[model samples]
Each structure stands twice: as C-alpha cells, then as structure tokens.
Target: MKRMSLASLAVAGGILAAQAAAETAAADDIFACYKTAPAAEPDWTAIARDYGHKRLKQGCGQQWPVAATPHPQRASAAAAALAVKTTPRPAPVSDFIWFVRKDFADVDMFGKPQSNEKATGAELSWARNNTAADTIWQVNGLVGLAYSYLNEDYSRFIGASLASYVKVDKEAHSAAASDDSRDAITVGGSAEVGFINPIGGADYVRGSWLETRDGILNRTTGQAKLEWMPMYLRVNRQIPGTFVTTNFRPDLKVQYDERQGGVVPIGFSGFGRSLRIGPEATFLFRVADFGTTLPAWAEPLAGLSGAVTYHWWREVYSGQSGSWLDSTIKYDINPNVALAFSYQKGRNEETAKRTDLYKLSLNFKTCAAFAGFSGGRCTADKD
Candidate 1:
C-alpha cells in the first residue's frame, strides 16, 4: 500500500509540471505577437494566426487591445504639424512699378521722306501710387523724360503728370517726340481726371489739360502753350479665339498755340480758331495662335505680330482736315529683342506737308521696380 501511494504521488507531480510548462510557453507566444503588431492599429486576425487563437484570446481578455485615449495638448500639436506640412506659402508682391524703353530706327524711306529721316528715341517713366484698395481718393503722380532725334534736329522734353481716377486700369501712353520742328529743350505738364470702366467694359473717359513750353504745332521760343481736351473716350475690344484686340480713341481738342496766338485748329491748320474732333483707331493681331494649326516647319512665323493704326481729324469751323495711316509688322526673336518694319503716310496739318515713309528698326525694353521684383518687359507705343 505504501509503495502504490508513492508511485501515484510522483505521477501527480509530473502532471502538474507539464501544465506549468504549457502555461509558460503560451505567455511567451502572446508577448511575441504583441511585439510584431502594426503601430497604427493592431491586426487581431494576424495575431491570432501567428500565435495560437486560444492563447491570444486568453492574453487579450477575448478582445483586441483598446485604443489609448489621446491627450488634448498632444492632439492639438499633431494637428498643427500636419497643417504646416500641407499648406503653401504666399508669393511676394511689389509696391511700385517703373518702365524704360529705347528705340533705334532707320527711317530712310523708299522715297526721300520729308520728316524723321533717321530717328532714335528713348523715354524713362516712373510713377508713385497708393495702394490699389484706396482707388478713388488715391492720386498718382507720374514724371517722364524723353529725347528724340529727327532729320538732323534734336528735341528734349520733360513732363510731369497728375492723374486722379476712380480706378486705375492701365498705364498711360507717352511719346518721345515734340509737337513742333525745333531743336530745343521743352518743359511741360498735364492734369487729367478720369474714370476707368465706368460701366462694365474696358473703357475710360477723361478730361485733360496739357501745356508745353514749345508747342508741337508752332515753335515759339520760351512761350508756353496749352491744349485742352474736354471729352476723351477710349474703347477697347477683343476678338475671341483669334487673339486680336482693337482700341479706339475719340476726343475733342482745343489748343492755344503761340504761333496761332489763340484757340485754333491744331491738326492741319495752326492759324484758324476752331475745335478739332478726331478719332484714332488701332488693331493688333497676334499670329502665334496659328502655330498649332500649321506644320512644324512653319513654327518660326508664329512669333510675328501685326498692327494697323489710323488717325483722322476735322476742324469744326475752318473745315480743315487731315489723316494718318500706319501699318507695322514685328517679329520677336525673344522677350527683350525684336525686329520691326513700319510704313507711315500722313498729311501734316500745320506744315501742309505730306509724308510717306518706310521704317525698319530694332527695339529693346526693360523694367525695374522698387523691391526685388521681376516682371515681363515694358511695352509702349512704337513710332
């Protein structure tokens, strides 16, 4: 009986040791599954497959591990970091704008031209403006210097302009030549009041008073003259799909020429006292739009552009009239350089002379702003 009891006790002890060893192996397998789990969210199915289902269920209390509650400060910081990584910074803008242009032309016409045989002109313009938000109350002051050489004669001009408008849409145009034939330095100024796009379209209406030291029509030494435009209208239009634009300007002009000594017709006759009514029209055609429709060999012609301008005026009282027609074709080699050919035919009202000329030229333009800002080349009316 004693021997039988000892053997049973040993068997009982062995069964207890086997049970202890199985529990220890199960615990180790659960720990290994947890170490290999995904960081974002644990995959219970994968854990159950790698480790035994019975052990996984026992280790996790028959369910997946509960997600940890996020702390408020930690969550907020994480959101901010994500926003910083995803957001884009704004671009820099400039406060002031400036422009400069230079033109060197060979104006020797096919027929011996009467004016502007060989001409070179340059202009520098600068302006200061308030912010674009304060449109109506903000006034812009513009100053310009110009020099021109024509037919062995040279002229210099310096002018300041003050313009107040409802809204500023585009830059004002400037010419590099004086009105009259005189080798002198002239100083002048102009004041303008206008509104841009008063209705809806790209149109403007302005009244201007321009005074010059030596008038273009009559060169009176050291005498100041005035020209007033009571009504000036500019109309602009664009054609769809064709890349064409048109601008038409019509105005009523009255001038006090020292040569005429009174408010006289300024277009053809400088002596008659009359108001002049005129219209100037310009049409621009951009040929580059056609390149896609043409063969690849004809791609070089895509950089060409053409412009046509017509100006006509009539004296109300004296019935004197004059007209000018100009056509130009330009080829742009690059942004800063261009080659152009132009033909001009005009009847001079003051000198009663007729002019017909052909011009071929090279043009260069550049710009600089107050800040370290860069933009396209400056553009101006070419003569």
Candidate 2:
C-alpha cells in the first residue's frame, strides 16, 4: 500500500511558471473492505489479519443504533422475549463476501485541455476468507495502475488508475458512487484510494496529504483540480428487475492559508479558507449477463448521476468571502467509458461580486486503451 500527496502548479494572471525542481512521491494506502489477500485473488492470510477487523467495527457499529434506542412496539416485544431467553445468542454470519472495486478517472490532466490522446490503468484485488464455512468472513485489497503517452506536450501526465475493495462485497460492485460512504459515521476509517501524478513537478505537493495540508497552508496552485477526500454511503435495494441506490455524502473539510508571517504595507494580502458538502442519488436497471447497466439519478436523464455542492469560505487578507453552488452530471457510455458535464457559480463576497465556471468531458476504453477529452480552455497545463 502507498500514499501520495499531490498538488497543482501555480497560476497567476493567467500565466504558467516553470518550477526549478519537483518530485512525485509514491503512495502506500491499502484498504481491505470485503475479502482477504486484497490483491487479485483470495489470499487467506492477509484476509485474517487486515480486513476482518475493519468489518467487525462497521457491523458492530450498525447494531448500536438498534440496540441503544428501541422502537415503541419493538421495545415491548423485546421485553417479553427477554423473560423466556437465558443466554444471549451468537451473531449470525451471512453467506456472501463483500467485494468492492475502486476506480479513478479525470477529464483532463492538471486541468489541461484534453487532446485526442489515450491513457489507462487497471488494478485487481481479492480477499482471504476467515471462516471455511462462512463465505463472507475475511479481508483483502487490490490495485491497478496505467499511463498514456499519446498526448503531445505533457504526455507524461496522461494516465488511468484504479483500486478495488475486498472485505465488503458491496464495494466490489459499487458503480453508483466513487468514494467510501460508510466512513462518514465511523470513528476512524478510510475507503478506496487513488493517485494522479507520478511525473509532476515540485511546485505541487507530492503525496496523500493534499486535502489536509492544502486546507491549512493554502499552498495549492491554480493547476490543481482533484485533491480532496470524499466519503459516500448508499442505500441500495433490488426488487425483481429494478434496483435503486441512494447516495449520501456529508463531508467536513477545512481549507486555510492566513499567509501569515508577512507584513504588507499596501494591497490586499493573499489569504483564504473554505468548506463544502455534496449529496447524490441514482437508479439502475438490472439487465441480463452484464448485471446492471444505465442508472438514473439526479437531474432528468436515462442512466445519469448528478450532485449539487455548496461551498463556503472566508478571507482575512481581503474581507470575508461568501459561498456558492456547484453542480455535475455524469453518464456511463459503457462499462469502460463515461461522459460528464459540470457548472459552478457564486459571489466572491470580499472582492468580486460573482464567479462562474463550466466543464464537459468524456472517458472511454477502446482499442485496448483508455482515452478522454474535455471542452473549454484549461489553465493548469498551458505555458
């Protein structure tokens, strides 16, 4: 398992500056959710040690709600049963492994314009069963990595990557959402991890500490696009030929950069902070062989997924900035391809009265390779 801290290049006055030196660090964050081994196939030893503990905590945590506070009618029934029962019964073990997969995709490299180039990465995972008779009791993890060199200019940044979950079987099939949904309620837990840059410069941070570090230092460059960590929880149900999945993600993030330690005689100082929250929902049609294809949720479209986020921030250098709205829409062109569109707008509160943003992208795997494209000019990669 590896961890990486990634950051974007600095952009000011719509200009890109070259860095003298920069390095991309490797990541070592391994997650075991449903099986053992955690690689491509079941590795029994790894399962017994790593993944088993994670699920026990999750399952046991779920029971607390039902045990601590009982419903009116349910409490009455429990009291009567207590009188007849002597010793408590052991917990029941289900008959399935919680298989999960982790997929990472980007519309553009470092917010650069998407060319007709191609890039891709893959990861495999498996879990080790704890109980010979219980098919679901165990833990494991998996990972996939790929890169593309077809693009001109910064072809080195072009690539695809993935990671999968092994203890909780549901994760293996979680296509409706990307981040971990269960971690929101847990004490200290994590979900699938992904890294985008191994060939970037030093002007950006190197490893997995981006969200927290950037939140505090405000050292992020304008070229940075995906650095935050998000958790997701989905309630999915299957009835006959139809399946429904609901996504809930409540994230608490802190971004800061007082740019303290310096005293400027005039002009506004560069300091800022922000917090954001987003939620999502979707419905899938269970098809034959392929299991499920084309799901619909949020917005109005067949096989679509969308979410709305609210961003709040403040700045001492200037004044107190306000908040704004961000929206997104995505569709699965197929198992290996996807298309997305996004928009954002709001007020600066301290300086500018309004801010606007828009984006569109497509990702697909064909001809034994993965490729993507985006509309609108990108600021992260140009000189």
Candidate 3:
C-alpha cells in the first residue's frame, strides 16, 4: 500500500497557506482604513483622499498612488476566503466491533478406535478510541456452543474471548505492503490484552474442582494474554526490478490464569506463564487506484496481524478434555461488516471418552444506530 506521508504532507502544506493568507488580509485591512475617512466629514474628505493616496501607494508598493477604498479589492479578498474553505478538514474516526463464527474437525488419539465430531462457536467484541478522548479502540469476543454426535449421544461445549487496544500517541499511523514488490518487508508492533475460556477439557474434571489426590485432574478458569504480533509495517523499498513487498514481525506473549468451577477435583491450583519469539506472515495486496479487484466471491478485507496458534488442556475427569489447532481467515463482507472464518481441528472426550472433532462456520454483521450518530446505510451487496 502507498504510504500515508504523501497525504499528510498535502494537508500540512494547506495549513501553512491558510496562515499566510490570514496575515496578508490583516495588512490589507490596516492600509485601507488609514486611507479612508467618513464621507460626512467634508473638511477631512480632501485630506482623507490625499492620505488614502499615500497609504495606497505604500500598500501597493508603487510610486504613483490613488486613494485607497475602505474595503480591499473584492476579488483578492474573496480568493483568500476561498483558500481557507478549500483547506482540508480532519476526518472523524471511531471504534468498532469485530465478530466471528468458528467450526472445526479432528481426530482423537486416546480412543481405541478414533472417532470424529463437529463443533461450532461465535466471537463478539467492541473497540474504542484509547487516546485522551477517543482515538483508538479494538475488540475480540466469542460465545458459541459445539455439539458432537458420537456413541449415539449428544455432547456440547462453549467458548468465549475478549481483547482491547489503546492509542499511545497523538499522531500514529499504519501502512501496508505493496503487491508489486517482493523481498522487501515492513516491521511494526502493537500490544494487546486478551482472554479465553473453555480450557480444552471435557471429562477430566468430575465437576469443576481440581483435586491433587485424584492425580492431576482437569479444571476450567480464566486465561489472560499480553501479546505482540507481526503487522504490515513497511512497503515499496527495493533495489530495482523485483516482486518483493513483505511485512515481517516477531512476537512476545505473557499469560496468567485463575481456575475455578467445572468437574475438576479440589486442591487444583492455576499457574500463569509467558512466551516469546517467532515471525509470521500477513495478507498484502498491491493497492489499486480504486482499492482492489478481488475474486467475485472474495470481498476486500482488513487484516491486523498474522500468527498461528495451538491450544491444549486436559482434566482428570471422565470425557472432559480437548485440544485444538486453528487457522484463521478474515475478509470484509462490505465496508461496515466483516466476516472471519477459522479452520479448526481438535479432539474432545465429552461423552464416549476421546473423540475426533471438526467444525466450519461463517459470520455476518450489519450497522446499528447509536447516540448522536447516523448509522451506516445499507447498500447493494459488494461481496
């Protein structure tokens, strides 16, 4: 993507021009006043005319002079006013919500004969400006129930999450990689706070308590994460002819957890931990004069980062354990609504103890009305 510095420079130059125009207008007014006198003052009229002539000469920077009028030349004055009006005004920005639905499939290793099952889930979150008033905000959340058809019985599970971000500076901007370039990369980093539930266990915890006597039983609790991931930071920096426009980044993550509830035996204690390192890839498209020309089935989308994740947790209870591997894809359904799909594979021992799992899902969204704001209007489908 083209850097935003070009646009920023344009705005800055306009501001400078407006300042200069205001100064010139003030000088013009002073010269006009000193040269003009009230018409009713008959005695002063002659003197006023001569004085006006002198001031006009000085003001116009010329030798021969003509009496200056009380008002400056209408044309010049109007031009100055117009310059101010044409100057660019700052655009207003706001926080928003990003939501998604998920599904996954996988195999169970603990079962005598591995069985397969399907699961579904949803995520919802809200973002807001974090600067003094409102300049930055982000969100991540999910709440979905998954069921499995195994052993002629039904098994279910739910997952949820939340995340947020804050703008650390008055003037901060982001850029993306160009599609025409290769072997060139950009680097940027951001800090985020996130949490997750349904700690990947089915029957390890008898109820919801962890008991040491029962040999490391399973338990459910809150998990918190502070992560720094790869982002689209640079673009268009190459030696000569080459297809290289890459955004590269490494991440550091810290986590903490507290456990309670579920079928886990008593005496279980939760622990927090941290992780670091590794680079990831992100989505980058050569920007077009009119955005992009995507596949008929694909809508232009916004991407924040690229990181692969693997999660696993097990409880000592019967049929209460799970593990997951997820690959994420996000695309814009249009300008206001975006869709995210995560390919997931995992194992769950919800009922029959050790069963394969699989899931697939699509998310949908629409604009809504809020205080003092005109909600986005519905238009023809862009996707």
Best by TM-score: 1
lDDT of 3 by residue, 1-383 (tens): 11223233344344444444455444433223333343322222332232222111123232222223312332233233334334453333322222122211111100110110011223232223345333221122221111111221111211111212111101121222211111111111112221111222122101011111111133333333343332223222322432222222223333233334346422212222112122222222221122345444333322211113354544333323344345544444443333445543552111111222221223333323234333222111111
Question: TM-scores of all models?
Answer: 0.41, 0.29, 0.31
Q: Which residue segments of model 1 deviate by more than 4 Å? A: 1-96, 100-199, 207-218, 221-267, 270-274, 289-295, 347-353, 370-383
Deviation from truth (RMSD, Å), model 2: 26.8
lDDT of each: 0.34, 0.27, 0.26
**Which whole-number lDDT from 0 to 100 does residue 108 have in model 2?**
18
Q: Give me the candidate number with maximum lDDT.
A: 1
* Global CA lDDT computed for model 3: 0.26
Where is model 2 more than 4 Å wrong at Cα?
Answer: 1-244, 258-302, 315-319, 347-354, 364-383
Q: Residue 69 lDDT in model 1?
A: 38
lDDT of 1 by residue, 1-383 (tens): 01122233334334343333333332322223344453444343343232221112223332332223323322222222223223453332222223322211111110111011111212222322344222111111122321111121111111122321111111232333312122222233324322222222222222233332223333422222232321224444556755444444343334332333324333345543335567555555554432247457656766666656666777566777777776667676665455667666885222233556465655433333324433211223222
**TM-score of candidate 1 versus the correct structure, residues matched by position:** 0.41
